[model samples]
Target: MSTTRRLRPGVPVASAPPPGARPVQPGLDELGTPLQDVTFVVVDLETTGGRAGEDAITEIGAVKVRGGEVLGEFQTLVDPGGPVPPYIQVLTGITTSMLVGAPTIAEVLPSFLEFARDSVLVAHNAPFDVGFLRAAAARLERPWPGFQVVDTVRLARRVVPRDEAPNHKLGTLAALFGAQVTPNHRALSDARATVDVLHALLGRLAPWGITHLEDLASATDPVPGDVRRRRTLADGLPDAPGVYLFRGPGDEVLYVGVSTTSLRRRVRSYFTSAEKRGRMTEMVRIAERVDPVVCATPLEARVRELRLIAEHAPRYNRRSRAPERMPWVRLTDEPFPRLSVVRDVRAGTAHIGPFASRAVAQQAVDALHATFPVRQCTGRLPVVPAPGASACVLAEVGRCGAPCVGGQDAAAYRPVADAVRSAMSGDPQDVVRTHAARIRTLVVQERFEEAAGVRDRLTAYVRGAARAQRHATAARCRELVAARRTDDGGWELVLVRHGRLAGTAVVDRATDPRPAVASLRAGGEHVPAPVAPATAAHPEETDLLLAWLEQPGVRLVELDGEWSSPVRSAQAVRDAAAAVAVALVAPPAPLVDDTPPASAPERRHTA
Candidate 1:
């Protein structure tokens, strides 16, 4: 006999196990449902032959049940519209004469479908019965109402041992489970026996937390030997939104992920064949343990997953594992500040990006430089310039104030620095429009290649500016609480601080959520005003929170500061920027001569 005790509903299993024993874990389905709330329709079919296309159904029997109580029963004989083969008569004891007065498949199907509505279909061998019904529907020129079918045979294989049950065949399972009715090769008797088998299998799965209809339907897939042995690694895992890691030999991290709903289900899914990625499959094969960290909200989980990936640099993680390498556009805090692409963001500096790459950040910088006379020199000059100081070509062409050569004093260069900072700070449309006008002038001159380069630079600037606006909006908030009604009759509450997710909770509509929100606020982490690297750890967190804030049905409950975005939608900004480029590149009108015409022009309309 197995030494493991049955898992109680709502109680967590032990995290550690005794030596030489496997740990018992709950099922991946976290949504608890009382078995009484589930409806099942046990069905059995007797047909002319095994092949659905070549044969016809002779009889159909079904029992609708809830919590072992029979709600209703359906039994009928179907006429094949042809003679029943002699062999079918011998096997089922159903003859051609017996079905002579039976209703045709078309006549009986509608009523049978109605009886099974809103119930999970159950059969000993589901495919055999379901296949014939589909065939019958095709012949009747009617659409089949696809039903969620459960096979008792497959369930038996999972729940009962082969040695104990002999085999998963109907008669063997019925006898093994001591079913209320014996399988006698008749539709009603076979269906009644399968119903008892289903109940027995469900009881066996109760410890695994398989109580819901969805879990029941999907539980039949056999767990591979290697994965089954490590099932204990999931013991005591909470069914909440969180991050999980798969560790291999020597405790090396193999993979990282976040689950918005149930972490258990998401982690367990990796070991199943449904994961088609070959690298992931190999990772699972070598996995030694599963470590999970639960978060109050999915947003927090996402942020944590990214941080963990950056920390570990696991081989299997494909994205966001190198947060340190993402490029940023930083304005150096020097006398005659110039835009520079840097890997690190410092405090008290105006910065524009955590662009996807350094090249993209440079493109934005280049575009802004083309329109504004910002310094392009890399030198750090003092108030008193040294004699014979060299000047870059940008200063010679009037593209810069020549601060390096002391041609322009710091007082005169302040406006240029302020313009660059303002253009980068809020509403970059001014810069875009100016550059767009330049591009239009070039286009009017038929400078196609030059126009293309300017267009690309404009595109990059708009995208980076939109992202920076969102980041700034999130960074400005000290605390925010919002709620939305979920489809499952519950309210989802999310708390955000600065930009990161602080907490989340789902509560029924009848319950007051004020206390939870208050507690979250009292215990939530406070983020200081937006600075450089501190705000750059998880850029995606800002994106996710922004998306959630914009979703329909979301209502703001509390706020420490006003949440607003100065930047418009990326597409709108891009269009406006492009329009500006068109105007700039247009040809200038010819200058008119100062000399007036000898005779005054005549007016067509007389007063």
Candidate 2:
């Protein structure tokens, strides 16, 4: 069977660039579109070499079709204006002499573009053909109308398992699908076979609920038959904000997720090709049904999601579920208090960080210990020195106050504990200055290695202090209204309280933002007040809000409480100390004698 239709013989099958060229929006219809309503132009190219920049197109072929009917055909040969590599000449059956009088790429691209207009571009490996065409158009200074691209290769990979197809190569697919035309490495012949393969791929989409053009381009996985059978399970889900669970055999939960948009819509999407993640695909395959736990608002949904994940520890859930596992920089509540890295933030203990890693938390603790003579020994400390207790090397080196030995009692050590708590909560100016001064002293003594160590400790201290200050400021805020411009022309309003996002809303340019902002603030006030000892509140939620606030370009729209970092904080002290240290270690300026040589100036006179 042959699908090739020879266009008017010897006609110029390519067009030159139009006089005025402008970019065109990618022509794609809405998602969930019926395949019959979408037009696709299957394209193939024969080039001199693989690279678009280095190679030249020898021929272009395309078949424009809709609903299994060929709308038109385009074919052309071009003089590549360069020698075709010997291997390519034998491989493609197109020789230099055969293209002696053929038009150049500049003449071919415009016509090809015209033929494939208003259709999704389809190719076996879409990138190769599309890339070559785009490169050719760019080289000829022609504007490329960004066309929607669909790869039949990707479609075959999703539709047919690797065991069934052997491989996704165009020829293999053409034969497997029993195409009317065979791909012979010739542009037109290959394109026609690709069209057949495309139709076959489309036929596979209906069962997976891929009826739209938008869905086709983004589709990378086919919904497994078992997963599709459970699609109706999402039917009863309310279109509201909530957490949804995908449960597998034996009622075992496979995944848990929170949706700010329609819970039903988001849950339903998993059954289609929209969700491309490999793990998600596997989870869906085993999922017997979806269970939705609806919430009043998106923020509530998010909070509930975190709670559920922490409770269930679902296999497919990765983050925001293990808040208790995060490390905190805790100041032990003892008479001789010492800074330590603890995973669990307990009551009556002052803490700074819920750092991303324990290493960072330890670094912060080390920074504090370096600046203050705090005890570094672990375990319970006896009020008085025990007869057998031996001092650690740190205490021997004056890094600790030797509180374990009763060298410094609780009353005497209270000031040091107070300074540490103040530094950790607010400014660490004295601590940063102490590290900085030590760094300079070490540099002056030419103890370069020790100086670097001091500098690193100082840097860590300043960073920890800064992060703590930010978190404290956020935690102290009664309410905060912040806005960040979204990708779409709209503003995303974030309502934060005690460092947790209380509520969120989006205001479009078409709406009166002030009213929405006011309404959001009013609703945000009703969120459950944070628990006492702020650390007891969800640190994950607090961390999430902190991350958002820390992102560049987020604007503070309004704040019910003061939101500020210490201007004369440890960070400032570190900068000053760094400058002094750099100057102290700098090479001495070349010496200049203050006393001039005792030489008289001589005058010459002409007679």
Candidate 3:
């Protein structure tokens, strides 16, 4: 799709400065196309229902206008491929019979798009009409052109007074603006009315210095003067995927962000009301410059953003502020290993979690304890207990094997410790099965509160274990190379080392990927082997990589070590967790007796 920018008919062109003279800097007025020069396609649509994706468009009408002159008009009836509701038919006066011989949306979309091409889209409620058009394009597997949209409803709300118009509806705005064509719920008439409303709103805004197309956004949203002045900070940024940092007075990073699309557009958005976060507004106010770090692929940009956030710990960046704070459930090194929630991972310690919180880690520990006869006490147990050491209540209650008091020798408890280690490592079936059976027993006994607590603990343990195992599987691999086909038929190649996103590159379609793959492997960051059961990278970063790898059509190009999970164990736990969740939500079945009372008759009564 092509977009054309045309100047107003009578506007004069500026001449270049003489060879010796200094070049003049352009002002904000010269930043974008003037309103009079912009071609706008006033559009309207009649759909089967209010929803965009689910409902189908029945009619499309658009008027392409420039310099207050109607250049061309397009109108078509579309076969929605479904029955229209009676209310819709009545409101639109377009019944199913009227659409019997009409072309389908797939047939009508191309012509409509061509007609509206190179023009800003103007609509009464822009999202409603544009959303349907976008949905149609997506359904047909066509790319929707990036079009500037102007919602006349929003403009009217800002320009018109409540005393002059009761509401900003299309009909009300049309009458208020004295439009020649009145909207009657039909597509073409509504579109024609919207054109007049748009022109009238623009005229009202013209006196307020909204003569340029770029000014319309600010006019509708009313951005602060200070923030708007800083838009120039993005003037030199490139239109590419990258990480951007907002630096403050002392050149200290205040905020960090990443953009897969044009970095300039993304940074410019912070000056508009589109960025509504109070903290971000404050950050932008104090921000002096925007620094861009361009990357070859979006994945690389994202990874760089994460690293920058971690390094700077920017105040405005709430996420990735303290990845080190993620808690892990580790089996400590001892004669009788116990689950301990620690912030760091040590070599040779069996671990299962980088859970969201310490509380969640504790819950998982409780679940493990309920299943395995591991010691729950915080104190460390010896290889041999004191001569007269007594067993704790946990041992008396049979909850623990009390190796602390020598009730069970290390030789006898070795199997139990090994089982716990196995569960934390990969095989969690024993733990899952034990927890599932106990939860079922509790539910049957009508101990619902107790069952819910057990269910939570079970869910926490299973989810954390599954996540940790997946991360560990990836982190243990010495090196891996993967590729996925991009939307444009190009290839997105990634190199991973010890689960860290080491490098990424994009290979254009029809180009040989071997060179890029070779370069990525050669230049990728070096990541040493991580401690056992802990990922080399932050858990969050590893999680992102795993999700990307699991996307459909991702192909593993190379692997140095096996990347696998205990499928049966994880799946069994997931199934049991899902069943318990359903059982908890549903009301319990009442106990029914088949035998009737001796004094009661088994006769049916007539109403």
Clash numbers, per candidate: 9, 4, 0
**Could you tell me how far off, in angstroms, the CA of residue 591 lies in candidate 2 after the best superposition?**
30
Q: Give a tens-digit lDDT track for model 2, residues 77-98.
A: 8899987653355356676777
The number of the candidate with the highest TM-score is 3
| Shift of residue 177 alpha carbon in model 3, Å | 46
TM-scores of all predicted structures? 0.53, 0.46, 0.58
Ordered from best to worst lDDT, the candidate numbers read 3, 1, 2
Sort by TM-score, top down from the best = 3, 1, 2
lDDT of 1 by residue, 187-228 (tens): 988988887888888878768867666576557774567865
Candidate 3: regions farther than 4 A off: 1-223, 434-452, 571-579, 582-607
Greater lDDT among 2 and 3 belongs to 3
Clashing pairs in model 1, backbone N/Cα/C closer than 3 A: 27-208, 436-580, 436-581, 437-584, 440-585, 440-586, 441-584, 441-585, 441-586
Worst 10 residues of 2 by lDDT: 6-15
